[model samples]
Target: MTRDGAGLRVGDRPYRVFGCNTYYLMAWAADPNLRRHVDEVLDTAVQFGLNTVRTWAFNDGEDQWNALQPRPGEHDERVLEALDYVVWQAGRRGLRLILALVNHWDDYGGRRRYAAWSSTAKRADDFYRDAACRRCYRHHARTLVERTNSYTGRVYRDDPTILAWELGNEPRCARDPSGLTLQYWLEEMSAHLKELDPNHLVGTGLEGFWGKWREGRYNPPRWLGGQGSDFLWNHQPDTIDLMSFHVYPDHWHMDEKATMRWIREHLDAAAELGKPAVMGEFGKRGPRALRERCFRKWLDATTSAATDTEHPAAAGALFWALYHDDYPDYDRFGVYRRHESTVDLLRSYTAR
Candidate 1:
């Protein structure tokens, strides 16, 4: 059940996914009563016509100064519980989930010092050192899907509540890595996930680097997208189901039109893969007009991608976040203002 040409077939055609990243879903899973909170967040998403929710399952919230490793299912108890409830409650709220498996972006929103993080020239040494870490991630992902599928009380598997499975939020780092190494990880991780829960769609998390590489412009720079991961991103689309990516108008808050143009180009570039080109991440700051413009540009970009341009393979778009907690107003990129309004617009781009 997939749609679009990017290797992602759909249960239904013309399915334009919409949702937000549960950036801190696991970090604050300390409350004894998390059901309501999860419902509230997802509730807002459903209320505004959202179709999905993306959350990170790795990073466990510990300071990742040294080699990143969790306490072997340390937060699994709470994290899975929250997810189970998210599926249950989200259904009640009328929403789905496009869950991310791992992430390198930290609180500072710059560099991540996680299990696979590395300096500009350094490699993901920790990933190489502790085989257990990788194994844990693979196993955990399998369990996540299995549990979701096993849900009996309004089961989530066959329902529309569960979206595609994302493998690694930006598998490539800010360093030039051996293409073989990165590909090996992506192929293996993606395979492992599908083997366990063959029901959901799966794909790697990219920074739109595939399109950027083809266009000769980039965000995290050339060194970040792996030595040559673009080949696999386009040529080997079958390794996963869809082509997912992230993007943000560099250092500009008024590039709504520009953002649309870039996404259109990305879709064109994805022509060969014949897959749905999805913007996994994007953001902006400045006047509300600027943000709304950029958002609208991308919204229009998804519903109608260009052909033979920089990108013609695009399929959908997912905003960076909908911060559900009280945080500083440093970057006004969030769609909401410490309230649920931000989350609302984040998922309101329906084609109705």
Candidate 2:
């Protein structure tokens, strides 16, 4: 395990991280094609030195509206089935999977209106409000967590393949969740996870852009502090034992010097809280040359302590992907072609 200066200890590490941002779980529709690809991806990841994986547990609709009573947070069989296989596969290959419980897509796809939390207060208004959502939470949230806490909804909770339980993906998305509603939901969800999955750590997948206009602190944008100063930092979401961050080129592109400098700025921000934060999702999706250039630049800068302008805050780094995209759109972002590549320069630094 490696613990960067972030003060958060990454279990089972040699200081640097080697992982892949994956979507195999998303495509699993209880089909053989999906299962085959899942094994292929995991095997490839292991051979390429990948030690960790950041994968999602369920989609918004994995267990959506039930025509029946729908009591509390009952998940459909699809979620349980998919997770069982995912955990089993990861465990077999020695890969740790960090499962994100909720995400913004489809029903909760950061859309203007998507109600995952409902209320049953004396008044409709009260029930519709966040307070009401909080009130009815335990019944719904606990059911969802309890089902997944076990190896199978059909079995018991004793899987050693899980790395952490994340409350949601980028709960800070203003487009989908209102600040207050999302914050309250996150607090409730995090607390719910702690009770359900105490065996593993918990966190939220957050994107790093500390000095943004959305926050109330720093008009001129000097620095930040405390919980209320920023997005993820603003709310001390429950069950968050570790932190994850995402980064990409700006609107267009940034050179090596600019990219490394910006990384430093964010690392400095995370360092103050003295919490371990992983660069969970980061990479340039363009021509192969551009991608290679960026990775080489980042790797060179990170491997050498001199390039880090601030404290060594980031614990591990995982590229955006490791699979081959069949379509033209996917090719631009995929780090490998149909056959995949061991030349994934980022994987070279997993031993860090």
Candidate 3:
């Protein structure tokens, strides 16, 4: 894997990361009966001309239903084997993956479990500053990075199928509105991941929300999650190879123009940092025409971003999810089954 300007290159070929989110692959890929569905998703992704994907690498302390690792340093061999199969399958299909190491939310016993394990009170921000918490996290991360893929008999660090490693799913520190703690956490974790595997890129899975903190204690009251997350300043870490931001205009009640401007501003920031950027996760629930219009505008701007300027062009855009209708409790986020128009739009730009 080589960095080519604002994008990536695999063996001298420019790689455009037009893709979608499939966070459940690790769990499903681990099951033999459900493993075929993993294949189906990748097949459809390739069919739609999507070359990259974003999925979860860590599912900590969850029940039997979906748990990659029931407890820290104790991985479910079945799930681990399934994840190995998923990696092999993606490599076979010639698709890339961006695996998130943790979740900021409580989906899979995230920070809450970590705090409990460390015998500390549940504070979302404590995961960043707590020494014991960081140690446990590092142990888990080290195990994953150094583990040899069962399918290929190759360590994950040497696997080219992995495009990058995201720190968390939309990480935030609501308590640290000043942005110092979150920034420090990004620096520490990113550096840790880089040390473990320098071949793959690392990113802070942040929802692009800019605020004033480093220069002075100035956080906008209207920030996205009542958390202190600065899109511009956070991506300034030396360990961060690219900038990742999620867009949810419809959910945020943002208009097309506003969403378009959000894309441009984040791209500009990436250009300033001399790093590539990707729309890691974005989508909405609404009529087909509206989704089409919004996606078309975003895709056009993303594909047309100028690469010659100091700021590099946008690297890629991955939609919220791609799930099939038959899947259990599927949230109806599948691109192939839900909206044909959006699929067409993705095909058109990804082929470029």
Candidate maximizing lDDT = 3
- TM-score against truth, every candidate: 0.77, 0.73, 0.93
Tens-digit lDDT track for model 3 on 158-193? Answer: 999999989888888888888888989999999999
Clash pairs for candidate 3: 30-82, 271-311
lDDT agreement with native, every candidate: 0.57, 0.54, 0.79
lDDT, model 1, position 117: 33
Model 1 vs. true fold: TM: 0.77
Off by over 4 Å in 3: 62-64, 213-221, 306-311, 328-333
Model 2 ranges off by over 4 Å:
1-16, 62-72, 105-145, 148-158, 173-185, 211-232, 235-238, 250-257, 300-312, 324-331, 337-344
Candidates 1 and 2 compared by TM-score, better number: 1
Q: Which portions of model 1 show Cα errors greater than 4 Å?
A: 4-13, 26-30, 33-35, 61-70, 73-75, 106-130, 148-160, 211-235, 251-261, 306-312, 325-331, 337-348
User: How much is the lDDT of residue 61 in candidate 2?
Assistant: 34
Taking the tens digit of each residue's C-alpha lDDT, what string does model 1 give over 1-352?
Answer: 4654542435454466666665555444425454455556665566556676776555543453211134444444554565565566665666666767766455412123334332232334344224655676766575666554323454444556677777867655334344545566677777787677677777677655543344454334434444445633533646577676666775433244555655655666566566666777777776766676667767666656633245446556777666544534456666554444443455455633
Error of 1 at 66 (Å): 20
Q: In model 1, which range of ten residues has the least summed lDDT? A: 108-117
lDDT of 3 at 310: 47
Highest TM-score against the true fold, candidate: 3
What overall lDDT, based on C-alpha atoms, would model 1 receive against the true structure? 0.57
